[model samples]
Every structure is written in C-alpha cells, then in structure tokens.
Target: MNAITQINPGIRQQILDAFNFRHATKIFDPDRKISDEDFNVILEAARLSPTSFGHEPFRILMIQSPEKRELFREFSWGANGMMNGSSGQLGTASHFGIILAATDELMRAGSDYLQDHYARVKQLPDEVIEIFNGAYGKFQAEDHKITSGREITDWSGKQAYIVLANMMTAGALMGIDSCPIEGFDMARTTQVLAEDFGIDTAKWKPAVMFAFGHRAKDPEFLKTRRTMQDTVSWF
Candidate 1:
C-alpha cells in the first residue's frame, strides 16, 4: 500500500485555504519566477498523484530558455488572451512552461511490469508467455481507433491530467501562479520539438502544457462553484 505522511492539522488547513484561494491567473510578472526548489516541490506533488494500475504514465518537459519560451508562446493560442487581457498588466510567465507527454514505450513498459508482478501469482502457469502474448495481442486488437501502443498512451494522458491538477493546486498553495493550457498548435509544436531534438515522431505525443510563474497581482476568481448540496444526493 502506498503510505502518505501525516500532515499537521494547521498545515492541512493552510493547504485547503490555498486551494480555495487559487484561480486561473491570466498574467504573471515577467520579472518574477518560482524558485527552483519550489518548482520541484510542485512537480513532486504531480509525482505523488495516483495513477491507474500503478502505471505512472507521463513525462514532464520543463522548458525555460527565453528563445524557446518565445517560440512556444507563438504556438500557444491561449497566449493571445494573456498578452492582451488582465494578465498582461501583471506580465507573463517568468518561469518556464511545462509540457506533459505519454510515449508508446511507457505503455509497453507498464504491460511488462504487470506481467512480471502477476508471474508468481497462484493458479498462474509457470510457463505461459505464449498464452500471455496471444491474449495481449487480442487486447491490442480490441482498440479500434488507434494501435494498442497508442491506446496505452491514451490511458496515460488521463493520468497526466491528475498530475496537472495536483501541480496547479500545489503551486497555488506555494504562492505560485499557473495557467492550465490546452490551446496550442500541438502538431506544429511537436514537429518543431521532434525535429530539433531528433525525437521519434511516432512514439511520443504531446498532451498539454502548463504556464507557471509568480503572480504579478492577485487573481480575481469571479467564477461560480457548485456546492455539495447541488452535486450530492443519497440515492
């Protein structure tokens, strides 16, 4: 079983208070950035997020170079809003942007882990690699829209969202600002990165990117939230 550390009651309240205080910051102060240690703490929160079947399926790409940030900004469709809106007054990301991805390798790797763990189970055949391979092939074939490898990546993408949320909440609690982004020229960005780094275009897929920095001003969280009374009902 996964063990969680006992947090102080006071600290837990602070964390909850932080969550309630966070909002989608439109702009960040360009002169301000999150400290390296603090950024790592935010990443650690993402790492601690639960995953399906214990397959922690995502790689985080922390991009920080000014040139790269500019290049990335060009493709981020959401940036136009940030550049011209309330966030503009505060400035834009001083810290690097984070890109999340899932690769074909991670899925195959997860399958291997599952097979290895199941090998010593009771009622399991001592030599059933062939049977297992066949079953795996069938399982792979069941995916209609994409290859089995791609399916694994799809599964990983969902897990990545859990990490995104954790990081956003964690960063906010640490007094960092974040913009969860899904609007980008993904294919173009992927092409640029893959060609530049010689990454296999077929294997890794871009999921989403996050913009992080210190908030230049307080975020106005004017959005409405649903209450427990509206959402929960005992059937």
Candidate 2:
C-alpha cells in the first residue's frame, strides 16, 4: 500500500472560510496594492494548475500599464458598471490579467506544436509520444467529438479557466479581492491585442480577464448557495 499523509482537519474549515470570504468584488481601493511577493505566489498557483495531456495550452498577460488598462476599459462593458467615476476594476485593481487559449492549429494532435511539446517539454520517448498522439487524437476527434475550429479553441479555453480559478482562489486565500470579467467585444479586444499588444491572435485567443485588489466596499448582500442535496447527487 502507498503511504498516506496526515492532514489537519481545521485546514478544511480554513479553506471553507476563504471560499465564503471571496466574492466578485466591484470597485477596489486604488490606494492599496498587492506586494510583489504575494502576487508572485498567486501567479505560481496558476502556473501549477493542471491541463489536459499536460499541454499547458494557455498564456497569461498581466496588464499593469495604465495605458493598456485604458484601452481595455474602452471595450470592457462588464467592468463599466463597477466604474467609480472614470475608474473601475481596470483602473483601480492592484493587478489585472488576461488568459489566452491556444487555437486549433496548436491544440490538434500531431501538430508541430504538440510534437515539440511532447518531445522537449514533456520529455516523452518516441514510442510514448506515438502512443499519446493516438490517444489524444481519439480524445479530440471521437471522445469529445470536436466538430469545428471554435470547439477546439473552446476546449483549450476550458483548460485556461482552471488556471484563472486557481489564480483568483489563491488571491482570495491571501485576503485579496478579485472579479472575473467576460463582458467585452471579442472583435474589438482581438483588434487591440493584435494592433496594440502585438499578440499573435491566430495562435492564441483571449479566453477571460480578471482583476485583483482590495475591495473599496464590502458586499451588502450575503452569499447564497444551493444545498448539497440540490446541487449534487451520490451513487
């Protein structure tokens, strides 16, 4: 039998508390900023997140420049409601991030990207690489039934969300507030990313965006959730 490590029971309560403490914070205290050490820990959490086939088909772009935030603010309708005067999460948050997911060309099996990834990054032997390619190809074509290019990109986006959630939860555990934003014009955002940020939109597309900071005001409403019986079923 494998060795089983002991875990503290109280650690579960602490995790629950952190989850309860977290919410989609709107406006943030502009004066307060997250220290580099703390933010690095959060980034590390994202880096350590798991991805399908260990192919980390995502990238994170940290938007710390005020000019870039302003450019995003012009197209981000989700953050507009939270704007205090001229600033919202984009303007006030201590840190902001955009998650980009790899496109079909990079995600499809037997692609040059996966070939290099399996060889160099994953360090798999040639035989193993051949096996994985077959398995992964079946997963993409048959198991998942990916029909269009968009579906492949969407699959990669699902992996990116894992990183996004870990980053936000890590911040929450550290007493930092965060809000995930998806309300933006995709075309406009893509244009800005290509023309302004100089990202290769063909290879990677924006999946999601989020902001982290200290909340300017505590939420007035209480957190609500469905009962376990209603939300989950046991065999």
Candidate 3:
C-alpha cells in the first residue's frame, strides 16, 4: 500500500511516538548490537531521503569492525576538545556511520558526473535539458561567487544532515538508540579516512558522524522541550 493510504490515526500516533522516543543517546550498551536486518532498514531510509536538485551529495560509510572502531576511538580521544574526549559513545556503540559530502568537482554543472545524474531522471528535450543545466550552472556560479567553493561543502553537508536525521528516526522506530556526533576534528577525520580506508579527501569530505546501539539505561536528564506553539507559527 502507498504511504498516504497507510496513514491512519494509529499509524500517525506511532510516527509521533517514534520521534518522542528518540534522543541524542549519550551512553550505549556495548554488548548490544543492531541486527543486520534492522540496520539495513535504517540505511534504506537514508538512501531514500530527499536532496536539493536531486544531487544525492552524501556518501555513508558504515564502520562496524572492531579494529576500525578502535582506530576511531583513539583518534577521537587524541583530538583536542572537551567534546572529543567525552566520545565514549564512539568506542562503545555497536556501529558508527560517517557521512561524507561530495566535493565541488563532482557537483559542478556540465561535469560528466552531474550530467549522468540528471540524464537518469528521464529523457528530456535537448532544449529543456539545456535550460536545466544552465540554471544549475548559474546557481553554482552564484554560490561560488559568495564563498569560493567553500559553500559547496556547506551545501552538501546540509544534505548529509537530512540523511542523518532520517537514519536516526528510522533506527528509533526499530528500537535502536543513536547519537549524532559532531565533536570530532574534521581535518583529523579526513586524514584518517584517507590513510586507513583509501578514500580520496579531495573528492569527498567528512561532514558528520553518528553512533548507533541500544541505550545502556534511562538518561539522567528528562525530556525537556518547547511546546509546539512556542516553536511553530501559522501563516
């Protein structure tokens, strides 16, 4: 059945409950692992997330091997910051997802990469396709004028956050806890990915990371949130 047809009152409530149950989990149960089936579902949610202009700018690296996790843990501890030092979550969590954003070269208009991406949507008249490409080029040019390609990373990184949120919510729906990690040193992370995984840093940059597992126990802090009226406004 389609999503619209399935959204009855019960299903709607379940959706809200999923959001309510999710939190930035600080402590994870080291022994508990998310089943492969459920983990795939979470990944699927990220795969299907929306991106601006259909650029699909994010790449996800799932780090689950014990040795690799140890490498990341040591890196996080060595990074100079309160947040990095407190990253026990990375060491103990069952899995880590590193989100990387595509570099300017891949997303540049008229590049073979983007042309191939746009061509796959559907066959368009040549004139229409030209118009689309021109518009995209103009947009990128304007973005570059303002930030000199730095905005490419910023824009692509924003898309990765969309995937991150979707994966976290999908995991929550499956009774998995998640922590959105933004405390690591980006330069060090880029170095690690290049040295260990052979990922080319010039082509893709690490945008963010996340930890997933079951929560060790109830959090000491209660759920404190602003009411809908306080945060939302009507037209």
List RMSD in Å for every model shown.
5.9, 1.9, 3.9
Best-to-worst ranking by lDDT: 2, 3, 1
What's the best-to-worst order under TM-score? 2, 3, 1
lDDT score, candidate 3, position 147? 34
Better of 1 and 3 by lDDT: 3
The model with the greatest TM-score is 2
Q: Model 1, residue 70: displacement in angstroms? A: 1.9
Better structure of 2 and 3 per lDDT: 2
CA deviation > 4 Å runs, candidate 1: 1-12, 80-91, 104-151
Worst 10 residues of 1 by lDDT: 82-91
Q: In model 3, how large is the Cα lDDT of residue 161?
A: 97
TM-score list, all predictions = 0.73, 0.95, 0.87
Q: Which stretches of candidate 2 lie above 4 Å from their native place?
A: 1-6, 82-86
Candidate 1 per-residue lDDT, tens place, 125-170, comes to 7566546555645554563333556676776788888889999998
83-143 per-residue lDDT for model 2 (tens digits) = 4464778878999878999998899888999999999999999999999999999998899
Backbone clashes in model 1, listed as residue pairs: 27-87
Residues 56-172 of candidate 3 have per-residue lDDT tens digits of: 988999887877766666456422123534447766688887999988877767777777776775456677778878888888777445234567878889999999999999998
